[model samples]
Target: MKKKKNLKKIILILVASVSIFALIIFFCSFVMIYQDVKDNCLEAQKEYGDDCVDSLIKIVQSQSQTYRLKNSAIWTLGQLADKKALPFLYELDKSLLPQKKCDLDKYLCKYEVQKAIKWFQKGNITSWMYGNRESWH
Candidate 1:
């Protein structure tokens, strides 16, 4: 009888351990998927030029998707560094600011957008000029 009780307890503990590990893996898979999307979008931006901006803006404006994915889209938009995207980003940040309190992801997205705006307005030499030639156009 003593051995049976011990076996039952061990089995319960093992089952619980497996369940927790599975949950962790499932959560991590989603995290990986979001990162993959961010990377692919960045690649597309470079390859597609202005063609990808509309699709990216749609992703940012999408309310049905997870905020993590949306945040990734927001960051990619900033990296695109297009002046056309600036207005949409500003509208998004403005909308989020009025909330009682936004999450850290939202704050980061807003910061990234503002940083891109500054770079657009401020980066004159394109960094690759090496001080030899400067074109402001």
Candidate 2:
């Protein structure tokens, strides 16, 4: 009986440790993927100019994409600074506000939309991070 109990406990510990590691890995993947989406969108905006618009919009609308990725797409739209992007950026800004109160990850999303709108208004279109960055054009 004693040996059987020790074996059961060992099995339980192994299963628990595996479950915790798997959860950690899954959650970490989302964090990494979101950051990658943001960076890649920014790079594409910088490199492709107006050509990136359609693809970025698709990412924003795609069901598979996360809020973090959509937010990055919104920022890229703002950075791209095209008049065509105004409505999308504005819509994102409107949608983001309510989410802010419920989700902590939304602060960047809210900030990016507001900054995009501000730059869109100013006709400067720089990132909120540097405000008045050297023009990409």
Candidate 3:
């Protein structure tokens, strides 16, 4: 009876450990996949030029897009550092600044727009690629 109980405890501990390890792997995979998509989008913009920028601008302008999607578009524009996007970005930055309190979804989008505008002004496209989020806000 003692041996059976100890075996069961060991098995339970092993199962729990495996489950946690699987979860960590799953999370890391998801992050890698997301980063790959972003990297691909940036590459596409570089290769395609105006077409990609136009599409990203449309995404930013689209009210139908979720805040996350819009924020992604804004970040991409910042990365591209195209002069054409500055007007639209300026408009967005100004619009977001009036709101003292942002809903959770809009807050990050607002921050991204602000960052993009700064990047445009400073012409710091390279650093924006590997930007440290802590210094921006």
Candidate 4:
């Protein structure tokens, strides 16, 4: 009887161990799936460009944990210049240097590059907010 009880306890422990390991595997798989979807969404926005208006809005509103990804999404939205992305762009612009590790000046200059591209695409020479040093505010 003693031996039988010990065997049952061992079996239960093994089952519990396997269950915990399986749960870990499942959790990792779920995270990978989530990342894949996120990457696909970003790529889709890049492919569709201005046509990705709704996608850009969705990305801006996404509860992503990564600041860089959120900022990149906002930058992509700004490139689209949908105006729907205005609030997010403004928020990202406001939070840009403080949250990111990169040099503030460099980051602002990068944003200017994108803005310049956007202005040129629209043929709006008067919309030169990028070169205005005071506009980083």
Q: Per-prediction TM-score, please? A: 0.45, 0.47, 0.51, 0.36
**Shift in Å, residue 100, candidate 1:** 12
**Candidate 4 C-alpha lDDT tens digits along 6-98:** 999999999999999999998786556444434534564664453344664554456642445544554444433445556555555565454
Q: Count the backbone clashes (under 3 Å) in each candidate.
A: 0, 0, 0, 0
Best by TM-score: 3
In model 3, which range of ten residues has the least summed lDDT? 128-137
Clashing pairs in 4: none
lDDT of model 2, residue 49 = 48
Candidate 3 residue pairs that clash: none
- Pick the lDDT winner: 3
Better of 2 and 3 by TM-score: 3
Ranking by lDDT: 3, 2, 1, 4
The list of candidate 2 runs beyond 4 A from truth reads: 1-50, 98-108, 125-137
Clash pairs detected, candidate 2: none
In the order shown, what is each candidate's alpha-carbon RMSD?
12.6, 11.8, 9.5, 16.5
lDDT of 1 by residue, 31-125 (tens): 56545544646544454443456666766665665666666666555554567777887777676534444564544356655655665567522
Q: What is candidate 2's lDDT per residue for 1-137, written digit by digit as tens?
A: 99999999999999999999999998786556545545655555554443466667776776766777677776666665667778877777777554434342444367767877787788652333333223322
lDDT of 3 at 70: 67
**Candidate 1, which segments miss by more than 4 Å at Cα?**
1-38, 42-50, 98-109, 124-137
